[model samples]
Structure formats: C-alpha cells, structure tokens
Target: MKKLIIASVIALFILTGCNKDKDILNTLNDYNISQQDKGYHFGDKLNIPQDVLDYAEAISISFGDKETSSLSIDPKFFSLGENDVTFNIKTKSGEVLQQDATINVFAKAKARPIAYEIANQYPHDTNSFTEGFELHGDTVLESVGLDGKSKILKYTLGSRTPILEVPQPSNIFSEGITLLNDKVYQLTYKAKKGFIYDSNFKLIKEFKYPDVIAEGWGMTNDGKNLIVSDGSKNIYFLNPENPSQIVRTIAVASNTEAYDQINELEYHNGSIYANVWQKPIVLQINPANGEVTGILDFSNIAKQNTTNEDDVLNGIAFKGDNMLITGKNWSKIYEVILK
Candidate 1:
C-alpha cells in the first residue's frame, strides 16, 4: 500500500510538470483582415502603404484601448465622441503595437429625442443581432446576423414576441432581408449570394449578385426596384429581375465630407429611410437625388436602454402607418410612428 501511494504521487508530479500554459492566444492575424471594420465604416480603401506593412504588423485599435495596447470599436461609446476610436492590438508574444493614426468618425450631432415621445419602444431579444427588419401590418420580419446563429424571425408588433423563425442556409452569413410580392429576398455577407424564400420559409431559389457592394449589408425594395446598402456611403438601386445591372446608385448626403456606414434601409412612401450603422440618427433620403431631407435623432433611445452593450444599430421596419427600429444587440424592438 505504501509503494502504491508513492507511485501515484510520482505520476501526479510528472503530469503537473508537463502541464504547461498554452501560448496560442488569438493573434490579430487569426481574425480575417477583411473583417476588422465590418461593424464600422472607413474610407473606400485603406491608405496602408507598402512601407507601413514592411516593418510592423498592421493592427487596428478602438478607443477602448486607451488604457492598454488593445483596441476596440464600441459604436455606442466611442462613436458618440469625435472621430477617435479606442482598441488594442497585442502580438503573438504579448507585445502591444500602435500607429497613432487618427480616424475621423462622422456621426451627426442632433438633440436627443425622448424615448417614449420619439416612437414606440418594444423589448427585443438580446440574442438577436438585428440586421434588417420589415413590417407586414403588425407582423414584423427580422434578419439576425452571425451565420450559424442567424435567422429570420417573425414577430407581432407592440408585443415584440417572435412567433416564427426560419433558419438560414448552412455556411451562409445572412445580412439584409426584405419581402416583396410574397417572396422574401435575403443577402449574404461577402458570400456574393442572394436567397429567395417562399411564404412557408422554404428556399425557393439562390442567385448570385454583385460583390462590389462591400458585403451586402442591407436591402429593401421600392415596389419597382430593389435598393441596397453596403455599409458604405452609397445606396444601390438594382433591377429585381436582373440584379447584375445597376439601375441607379445614390450616395447618402451628410453635412460633412465624411462617410457614414449606411447599414439598414427601408422605403417609406417615396423616401428612403436608412439607419446609420453605429449612430443614433436615421436619415430620410430623397430617392430622386439621394438627398437627406430629414434626420431623426434618437439618442435618448440608447440612454433609456442602459443595460445594452455598445451594439450596431442596423434594423429598420416600416409598416402601414408605423415604423420599427432595432439594433444588432438591442434588447427591444421599437414601434416608431414619426410625428
């Protein structure tokens, strides 16, 4: 019995000695370089010169990294301030890096609207990263992001309860979603594919579309043509019959020369309603000239929902006489009736 105890102790000591700490921390390179600013907007192309990448590993930092070398892009927090973002970029060996390059974020400055007075607010499921939302009477159709977990949820207005959910295709990252003539049209992120679903949520058809639109962020229809946004400063008008042909393209107008990430879109009456990805404002755009006529500031909406994290505000639904707005990680869906 004593010999057996001694052997067990030896084995335990050897195992503990061999158990070393794992060194494989997630490197900045492990993440797809293309996805660095997926949730935010930047220039049409990075200005990173070959000389810049020659020596240092190219990394992005958000304003949250102010204390450490890490970087973050919390839209609700840093995006509210000037064009500065805070984040961190640590190396494979725990080394931190920085460029001190200043980024200019362009968020509209407007008065915060009262949560109750601005529009109707509905509690949403936090699990849903709402990308697109549309309304059929009191019924709301929503597009949730992140491939495996993404889905189309049908909910009742005012009540904010999802009554139906349709899973997306395997390996497909669902982005924008809209219904026209009883058929649902959905866009995939960077997949260059569009899916068509029937009333029963069955896959009817899958088609290829433009890849130049910068990840197919949002989609909507104007009864005659399909309008889409790509997290850029422009909106695309395409022929629903033939999406390959660009019918028209409209650049979202802002007071400044900066570009805003136009994520979700809805066509109400004759104007285009777009949700600027990380901002608290919604622009009322003129379809004819692509001019922003009115801006609805809902800063108070975020203040009321203090429990939510810094999320991407991307969902917009327009029903008959009512409008609905939701965010990527928001806990509620708001039924907004603009006064």
Candidate 2:
C-alpha cells in the first residue's frame, strides 16, 4: 500500500511539472509579435506583453549566436528583414524557457519612387534568354541561360553582334556575370559552380558556390568583393579570389517588409540595383545594410517588351551615365535616365 501511494504521488508531480511548462509556453506564444503586418523598424522597441512580464524574471534575445539583454531594435542589435531570434526567459519558477520566433525588421524610411525616361534604344538578340548584364567601357557584357544554350558574350553598345562570345558546356545552365580586376566571373544555375576568365576571355579556373547558396541568380562587383544573389531576400558578398567564401550576408528589406527574388545585380554609385523577378520593378538597395532606398517602376517598359509570361524584364546594365535594361528573349534594349 505504501509503494502504491508513493508511485501515485510521483506520477502526479511529473504531470504537474509538464503542465507548468505548457502553461508558460502558452502565455509566451499568445503574444505573437511577428504577426504585426507593419513590423518593427530601427529605433523601435518590442513591447513585452503583460503575461510574459508577470511570468519571467529575466529576458534575453539571441540572433545568430549573438545575445542581448535589451529588446531595442537598433541596427546594432538587429538587421533589416526577418530576424530569427530566440527568447531565453528565466521564469519566476526558476525554469528557463526558450522560444524561437521570427522578428521582422523593416527599413527606417519608405523607398522613394523614382520615374524613368527612355533615352535611347538598341537592338538585342531575340534568341538570348538574358540573365545577367553589365557594361564596361563601350562594351556590353551579357550572360544568357538554358541547359544546352548557356553562354556569355560581349558586344559593342550600339551593335547586335557579339565581339566575343564564350559558350558554356552543353549541360551547364549559366546565370549572372560580373567583372572585377579585369577578370570575368560567371555563375551557373543549379550546377553550383562558377567560372572565372582572364581579361581576354580565356578560361582561368572554376570554383563552387558555398554550401549555403543553392543556386546563383545574379552577380556584380563593388570594385572589391563580389555581390551575389540567389533568388532570395539575401545578398551575399563573397571574396573575389575565393568565390566559395562568404564575407557577409544582408537581407533586403524596405519600410513595409522584406523582399525576395532579387536578380540581375548591378553596383553603381554606392547603390546596388536589383531586379525583382517577373515584376517590372527595379530596387535601389543600400549595400551597407540592405535597406531599399529607391524603387523604379518599369511597368510601361515591361508592357512594351512582354509578349508572354516568360518575357519578364531581367537585365540591368549601366552605359556611361545612363542605365540600359532588357528582358528574356527581348528584341530591343532601352536606355533610360533615372529621375
């Protein structure tokens, strides 16, 4: 009878402990800060809920192995876009409760809407499924994609024929291209490899993408590091000497929320201009923290070129002081001046 009584009491204690933890979790889960459509921004404070306040003795936040006791959304404490954070709560019961959640941080200012005026037009290859584009001196460098037809080419600004064209292997689907230190860098889609070339377009070497990036979408350079996008909200800065090494990562976001499908990158005048896939819009992002500073709506230009769904605007290049844009299988390229 005594053994039976002891077993009953022990079972009751275990049940009570489980219920306590569940109740505390329920209280913490009830306050969902991430659900707020207009998320927090720089200089904002995450309001602690009354229930959490009552239940916790100490609260701490952790992001990417960095932990802080304060909940301020300072740029030093948090980054733009989605922040996956862990709340380490020391409860009044001397129990530690860890809650993992997403805290979205937006840009401080709304993205300025910029308009464009067509400056000139040039002929482009309708057969080119244009992926990456940029201009160096009087030459326009382009990278086109497809399983059997991926190639990189460079042509004069006003001409349709390429002065230099290099085709990829038949099975390789190439994506973006960039130039740094007079060497050409090109990324491959899904193949997880990148090709480097000498100034004269001779194959120098090949390297693989880091384990974190699954696919390469666009690439450009800031005179030093190579800035790459993987069709996500992230922009990865990599070492030009070693493409597999990640220098840093920034998540692109505006005042309202974070954005994805960042493609066709171009670094010019301290801003990284990017194309949002399938949308006739170009975003000017501040590379310092991935805060979107300006937006250029190219809906009319897209309408002029878009014949079917796949003919979305997907190219960005700078010609002298003006910007040049084209699309997949586009017959014409338009030069524009940003206002």
Candidate 3:
C-alpha cells in the first residue's frame, strides 16, 4: 500500500507539470497580438497592450531584431520616414512563438492655425513666371520657369526692371532659387540637375538632384541648411556642402489631412512658409516636425490678380516686418504682416 501511494504521488506531480506547460502554450496561442497600424510621431512612447504585458514574464519582446524588455517602446528605433517595425514574441526558453505583429511609424507633428494680414503692396513684373522669390538685402532674387523662358533675375523691391538676368539653357526649366552665403543655388524641374551660381549670376557648378525626390519644386535656407520641396508632401533638408545628400525629410500635413504639391518655400522667423501648388493658401510649417501651423489665405489676391488660369500664387519673400507674395504673370507684389 505504501509503494502504491508513493507511485500515485509521483504520477500526480508529472501530470501537474505537463498541465502547466500546456497552459502556457495555450495562453500564448490564444493571446490576440496584432500589428499597430496607427501613426505615431517622433518622441512618442508606444503603449503596449495589457494582455501582452500580462504574459511578459513568459515571453520576450522585440522591435525587428532588436530585443527589448517588457517596458514601453522607444521611438528612437524608427527612422525619420515611413517605418515598418516588426514586433516579435518569444518564449522565455528562447523559442519563437509569434512574429507577425508590426507597427507603422511616421515622423510627423500635430499642427495648429496661424494668422496674417495685408500690410502693404509693391510692384512686380507681369511676365515673370515666379517659381522662386527671396529678398537678399534690398534686392529680390527671382527664378522664372517654363521650358524656353526659364531664367534668374535680380530686381529691387519697388522696381519692375531686372537689374540682372541670367537665362537658363533652353532645355532646362528652372524651378527654385536660394542664396546661401555669396552663392546662389537653382533647381531644375525634371532634368534632375541643379546649378550653383555666384551672387552675380555666374554658373559655378552643376549637381544632380538626390534620388529620393521625384522633382524639384521649391527651395529655401534657414541660415544653415538648404530646405527643398518636391511637389509631394515631403520637404527635404539638404546639406549645403553636398547638395545631393539629404540630411532629413519632413512630411507636411495639416490637422485634418496631408498637404501635397508643396511648392515655393521660404524660411522666416523660425518657421517655413510654403505655397501650395495651384492653391491660393500659403501654409506656415514648423520645420522640426512638418506641421502646418498656419494658413495664409491668398484666395482674394488670387481672384483679384487672375488674368488667366495658368497664373497661380507662387512667390514668398520676407522684407523687414512684411511678407512679399506674388504669382505667375503677376503685375504687383503684395506686402502683408502676420497678426
């Protein structure tokens, strides 16, 4: 009887061990681990599901191949652009269990509205297809576009006549112009090429556009780096030393939707002012996170200046306390102060 009792106790112990293992496997199988499809900006901490936390002791967590503890996810693991991070769960014994879960990450920021007013007005050339406009000292440097009509012109604030003009090659359609130090950088439309010229309109060198951008649409500088825009929702920060290398990318968006066709750019007072292509509204963007914090309504100006359908508001420049804005074939440059 004593032997039989000992044997029965041993059998019970074995059965309990097997049940525990089975329970652990069943718990892992039944857990609903799904990929997070929502967008998260940089500096945001990801919230792990409570269910996953409950089983944290039995499994390991990781983003892609980088192993992580049961603690919250760190956003630093992701890149500046769109990212797909694979999340995996493994047994404490180092056996893989689930690896299908993923998280979609976006480097974006929340946006708020900014306001402005029409402070003043100035004269501009009606024939200038203004693609790029900037005020260097008291001179307005403009880049005009169109296959056969592309050129760079330098004019005074109140003058309609260009003090200097440099015509582009007949095949190259100039898009945007930016002056950094004593050099002027000009981008082409679809040629995938750019020009480096002196402030006096002498061509110094030519560079190919970075492969990341589809085409050049706008360009600006923040006293440090060159900020560029392709007609897409993205804005690229390029290294001045190497214009083809992209330093970073920001996806522009409003509170409700992403803003694409982001044309002519100007960096002023710690913000990026962008003219949306074919749209009369200028978006005030936070360069750090690509958020459209303000919308400058140019609809009235567009309607008042419209001589043809091809003419759209496309120029932005800062002079003293006012902003200079104009369009293709525009006869006047409107000066406005932001409230």
Candidate 4:
C-alpha cells in the first residue's frame, strides 16, 4: 500500500510541473499587448491587458532627451507648443521604448526677422473684399466677398487689370476660388451654392452645398480633390465629384486661444498656404495631415500702411513657382519668395 501511494504522488508532481511550464510558454507566446517600439498619433489610443496595466504604475514620455512622466491636457491634442516632438516611453519595469512622432500644437506667430523681399506689389479695386486668389501662367483668378457684391475676376498678373469678371447670383456672398484644369470653382458664404466658371470667366455649372456647416470661408485644391475651410479652425478635404463626402478634416493650430479664421488658401509644392481672415499672417502647412510646419508673418505689410487702416491680409496666389500675395483694399500685390 505504501509503494502504490508513492507512485501516485510522483505522477501528480510531474503533471503539475508540465502544466506550469505550459502556462509560462503561453505567456511568452502572447505578446500582442507588449510595448510598442514607437508611440502613436494624438488621436490614437492603445489598449493594454489588465495584467500589463497592473504591472505598470505610470508611464514616462520623453521628447528627445527631456523626460516628461506626467502630462495632461483639457482635451489632449498631444502638442507642446510650436516645436516638432518625438518621444519614447518608460515603464515600471525599467524598460524603455521609443516613439515615432512629431508633436503638433497651435504655434504662436513669433516675430521672426523678415526674410523675403517685397519683389513687387499690384493693385485691386477698393470696393472688392478679396478673399482668395490664384495664378495660372500670367493670369490671376480672384474671389471677392460680401453678399450681393461678391464676384470672381480673372486679371492679368502685375497689371491687376481685370480681364473677365463673373458676378455671384444676386444676393449670395462669394468667398474663395480655385482653378482646376480649365474651370474656375468659386464658393459662396451662406447660399449653399458653388459656381464653376470656364477659363474665360463665363458661368459654366453651379453646384449646391448641404447645410452640414454654418459658413463657407476659404478653399484650394491639391490636384486631386478640393480642400475647403470653414470660418472655424477646421479644414475639410472633399471629393470633387461629391462635395458632401469628407475625406479628412483637421483643426488648425493658432498661437492664441482665438480661432484663426482661415480665409484664403494656396497649395504650393506639397504644402498648403493659408491666410488668416482679418489678420496679417500666412501659414505654410502640411496637408498630408493638418500640421502647421512654418509661419510667414507679413505684419510688415500691415505696418507699412498702418495709416490707411484698410490693409487686411486676404489673398495668396502662386505664379509658376513664385508666390504672389495681396491684401484687401491695398493698392499693391506682393511677389514673395518663400525661403
């Protein structure tokens, strides 16, 4: 009887040992929730297993060499001001992990030494509340604002003389305009109508917009689709064929708490350039996702004609490879060289 008992005990011990080995192997194999080599975007959320979460007391995030263990935000946008940020993560286990990132925040317009020269300035009518402008070859296309007074004009570069002008439907306020192929597309403020004009500035086709948003402010194109801006901080990418469908939307970054009312837009190289409504500043932004990479403070232009008080920055046009910018009621169109 003793010998039989001994054999049974020995078998039970071996079975328990095997089961423990299997559990350890399973833990080793289940690595789906393990630490990622890089951190994700601001909007990305990561889920950790309960066991991993319990093991982690806190996480340390580092940008470059500076370590920030506890960071907080009202509505977290993952930005630490104007600088591009890359980070790494540290855990309770003393293991460090790297994050592939660039921090994006509302960048304040700092007073950088003006780098570009005022190549030239052109003139527009004093009554035209110009909102957007673009250049194709030597021809300049413009959108003038205000209800019952808005229109799209095609002008000769340098001369500022209008070659063709197409007025918006009687009572609708016109806003931004852009050119794709041979057609000039124009947006209206609240009438929900967008007009397409031929190269000759003749009315070709009209499209209607749904009341998805309150106001139409600015617009540009990326050679593929139309990009529009509402007066708020948000910018929307839309399908050219279907205006209602949104491809993507991004909240613009402003240095101040005030929302930068984006008024005009121009796509140059791979970046999107925008004019702040009623302000004398332009931003060079990344369009892949909405990241404000650089800033061009044309406050000098605002200061130049401080006596007039009518010079508000409003227009941006790219001529060939050069950029031509203008202001409302200002007599000069500026040729700017982006450094």
Candidate 5:
C-alpha cells in the first residue's frame, strides 16, 4: 500500500511540471510585437514589448550576421523585399534560445513607369529565340538559346540576316552574351560552362561557372566589368579578366515587390536595364544599389509580335540614343526612345 501511494505521488508531480511548462510556453507565444500595419521600413524603429524584452537577458538580431543589440536597420543589411531574420537570446538562467522572424522592407520611392515612343522597327529573324542582345556602333551582337539551336550572331542594324553566325554544340544550351574589351563572352544555361571569343569570332577560350551562379540567364558589361544574371533577383558583376570569379552582387527590387527572372541585361549610360522573362516589362535598375528606379512597359509592342506565351520579351540593346527591344521568335525589333 505504501509503495502504491509513493508511485501515484511521483506521477502527479511529473504531470504538474509538464502543465506548468506548457503554460509558460503559451504565455511567451501570446506576447505581441508592438507594430501596426505591415512591417518596419528603412527609417522606422523596431519596437519590442517591455515584457518580451524583460523575458531575455541579452537579445541579438540579424538578417545575415548578428549585430550586437543594434537596431540593424542599416540599408546595407536589409533589402527592399522580405528578409528572413534570426534572433538569439542569452537567458538569465544561462540558456540560449533561438527564434526566427520575417521583416519586409520597402523602397524609399515607388518605381515610375517610363513612357516611350517607337522611333523605328527593324527586321528580326523569327527563328531566333532572342536571348542576349547588344548594339555596338552599327553592328548587332546577339546570342540565341536552345539545346540544338543555340548560336551567336553578328549583324548590322536593320538587317534580318546575320553576317557572322557561330553555332553552339547540339548538347549545350547557350544563354546571354556580352561584349567587352574587343572580346565576346557567352554564358551557358545549365552546363556550367562559358565561352569567350575574339572580336573576329575566333574561340579564345572556355571557362566554368562558380557555384554562386546557378543558371545563366542574361549578361551585359558595365564598361569595365561583365554583369550576369542567374534568373534570380541577384545580379552579379564578374571580373572581365577572370570570368569565373564574382566581384559583387545586388538584389533587384521595387517599392512593393522583389523581382526575379532578370533576363537580357544591357548597361546604358549609368543604369542597368533588364527584361524580366515572360513579362513585357523592362526594368531600369540602379546599378549601384539594385533599386528599380523606372519601368518601361511594352504591352502594345509585345502584342505586335507575341503569338503565344512562350514568345515573351527577352532582349534589350542600346543603339545611339534609342532602345532596341525584341523577344523570343519575334518577327521584328522596335527602336524606342524613352522619355
């Protein structure tokens, strides 16, 4: 009888302890973060409740690296879109507690829609799945994609046929191309290989991509360095001498949303212009910081060439003072002046 009573008392004690732990967890979970509306912006201060602040001895927050109790709202640490954050706390009892959070950052100004007028239309080969495009002087340097149909073409402006064509191997899918320092650099989609050619189309060498670039989508040169996009919000600048190395990366975003599928890049004047895959819009992105300052919508221009959804806008090139744009299997390219 004595042993039975002792065993029952021990069972009750365990149950009571479990219930107390659950109640404490519930109280902590029910604590509210003192923010209204959506989330914190660049200038907004983060508000932590007094009770919650009192719950931990030391709290550290970070999006990439944990800063020692600072607000961490520095523009360098936060992007314009959603940021996944980690919170580490050193408790009074010497226990370490880790928590996860999400904070959406907004741009300072909304991206404005840039109006444009079509100056002229030039013939483009319908057979070409336009990927990379550039206009240097009176010549057009373009790269087309597909496993067997991928190739690079050099032609004069307003011409439908290429003066020089270099076909890629049947097994590899070619992607974006950029011309820098009298050399042509071409990217492959998934093969992890890239090619460089002389100004006269002679193969100079081949190189492999680093793991940082997953899939090559668009490429252009910002005067000195070659810029590349891997179908993501991030745009990478590579060393022209060493194409395999990444020098810097910037995430593209607007006031309301983050952008991906950044295709067909072209650097003009001081900004980086790009075409988003499957969309008839071109974003004029700030190269220094990845803010999408302005947008060029070509819904009317896209309808002129689009027959199906696959033939989305995918090309951008600057000619003199005009912008030359075309799409996948687009019959004609339009030269428009951005206002």
Candidate 6:
C-alpha cells in the first residue's frame, strides 16, 4: 500500500509539471506585445519586453520582411514613413512560434536644403492679400484675404485686372481655395464654413468645414483628395465627395523637430510644397509621411518684395514647368524653375 501511494504521488508530480509547461506554451502563443507609445523615434533604443525575452529562445526584429536591427532607425528606414516592426520568436528547439508582435516606427525630422533658381517673374496685384494661388493654363486664380476685402479673383498671367471676381460675405474672412474636378472649393478663416463654386466662379453651395483644425490657412488638391492646412503642424486630407470628413492627417516635421504655421499649400510633381507662415522658406514635403524632403529658401524673393512687415511671403502656384510665387500686398509674382 505504501509503495502504491508513493507511485501515485510521483505520477501526480509529473502530471503537474506537464500542465505547467502546457500553460506556459499557451501564454506564449496568446501573447501580443506592442510599443507603449505606438511609435518610436529615430535613434531611440529599441525596447524588448522582459516577459517576451523570458519565453523565447531567440528573437529577431524586422521592418516588413527585412531585418532592421542593424539599421537602428536610420534614414533608409525613416524615409519609408511609418513602418511596422515585427518581433519573431523561436522556441528552445528553434521552432518558429505561432504568435508574433509588431510595433510602429515614426521618423524624426531631418532638414535638407533644396536649391532653386529664379526662372522668371510676372506681374501680380498689389491690393490682393494673396492667401491662395493656383494656375489654370496661362491664367491664375487667387483668394484674397482680410475680413472686409475677402474675394476670389481670376486674372490673366501678367495683368492686375481680374477676368472674373466673386466676393465673399463681408463678415466671413476667407482663407484658401482649391480646384477639384469642375468645382472650386474655398475655406474660411474662423467661420468653419467652406464655399463651393462652379467653374464660372458662381457660388453653388456652402458646407461646414471639419472642426479638427482651429483655423483654415491653405488648401490644394492632389488630383484625388483635397489637402488643407490650419496654421498648425498638421495637414489634413479630405475626400472631395465628403469635404467635412478627414481621410487622414500628417504631422509636418523636419529632421530635428516638428514645424508649425504651415500655410499656402501647393501640390506639384507628387510633392506638397507649403509656405511656413512668417518664414522665408518653402517646404517640399512628402505627402505619404509629412517629411520635409527639401527647403526652398525664398529669402531673396521676400527681401526684394517686402513693402511692410505685414506683407509676408504667402502664395505659391504651379504654371507648366515653372512655379509662380507672390505675397500679400506686394508687387510682382515670381515664375521660377526649381533646380
């Protein structure tokens, strides 16, 4: 009887050990670890959870399918925008586990000085407090700002006289304008309303803009969607069919830091170019990641065109292969080929 009892006790111990091992395996299989902040900056030390380390015999980190541990959040990884880092686990026998973990990687701002040459200059209206500018063939469309003076005007390339003019409500302060399909969409500064007009510059509808932005500053369309800035670091993409709905938001950043006061946007050659408010630099930004790929210094243009401190550089438009830029209450419009 004593021998049988001891044998039974030994069998119970073995069964308990097996159950413990099975529980560990079950926990490992179900474990899903993520970065605490949902994003890691460039050069930030990669953090591996202690629990994850204790369970796995070998661990490998990868961006997409390629191992990124060696890159260490370098430029190559950052330039690709947000990335998913997968943690692959292996068991004691080098058997791949069923469960894997993923973390998000974000880029740290990096500055790149872009070069440009003045290809030509054109005549622009001095009375126009240019907030939005766009080119349709040889003609130019502009949205002039200020509470009492707000209006949308279409002008011939070198003429101060407008071909067509549409006035906004005297109380509504107008901001940016963009052309989508056969319609014109315009933003207001603080009213949280946007105006839509036909190709002939006649008001067809007025819709409420999204409240995600504090104030409207600039707007442009990328063939499919409308991109808007609100005098902040954020740029929002909106569906044309549903103007109030935001498709996504991109936070503008340089190599070392994030930037604010992004205004007067223009989409050209697959890049979003914006004027940083009150600054003499135009940022060539990547739409996918909000990375400032290049900085076009407009100090020369600003210095040559400044009538007063209020007349800051503001307008940007694409005309064929050249870019047309102007400012608030300033004289000439510059047509330059970015080199």
CA lDDT of each prediction against the hidden true structure: 0.66, 0.89, 0.78, 0.67, 0.83, 0.79
lDDT for each residue of candidate 3 in 220-244, tens digit (9 for 90 to 100): 9998899999998789999988999
Off by over 4 Å in 2: 1-27, 33-35, 64-66, 74-77, 307-309
Give the higher-lDDT candidate: 4 or 6.
6
Lowest-sum lDDT 10-residue window in model 6: 28-37
Name the top lDDT candidate. Answer: 2
Q: Which ten residues in a row have the lowest lDDT in candidate 2?
A: 27-36
Best by TM-score: 2
Tell me which of candidates 1 and 3 scores higher on lDDT.
3
- TM-score, cand. 5: 0.85
CA RMSD of each candidate after superposition: 14.7, 2.9, 8.1, 13.1, 3.8, 10.1
C-alpha lDDT of candidate 3 relative to the true structure: 0.78
- Candidate 3 residue spans exceeding 4 A from truth: 1-110, 307-309
Clashing pairs in 4: 39-99, 85-103, 121-333, 122-332, 122-333
Error of 4 at 9 (Å): 60
Candidate 1 per-residue lDDT, tens place, 312-334, comes to 56677775656677787777877
Question: Which stretches in model 1 have alpha-carbon errors above 4 Å?
Answer: 1-116, 159-161, 306-310
Candidate 1 Cα RMSD (Å): 14.7
Query: Candidate 2 on 1-339: residue-level lDDT in tens?
Result: 999999999999889977876776776666655355667888888877777778789999998869999978878878788778888989877889998877888888889998889999999999999998999888989999999999999999889898999888998998999999989999999999999998778999999999999799999999989999999889999999999999998889999868888999999999999999989999999999899999999999899989888889999989776889999998999999987
TM-score of each: 0.63, 0.88, 0.72, 0.66, 0.85, 0.71
**Model 5 local distance difference test score:** 0.83
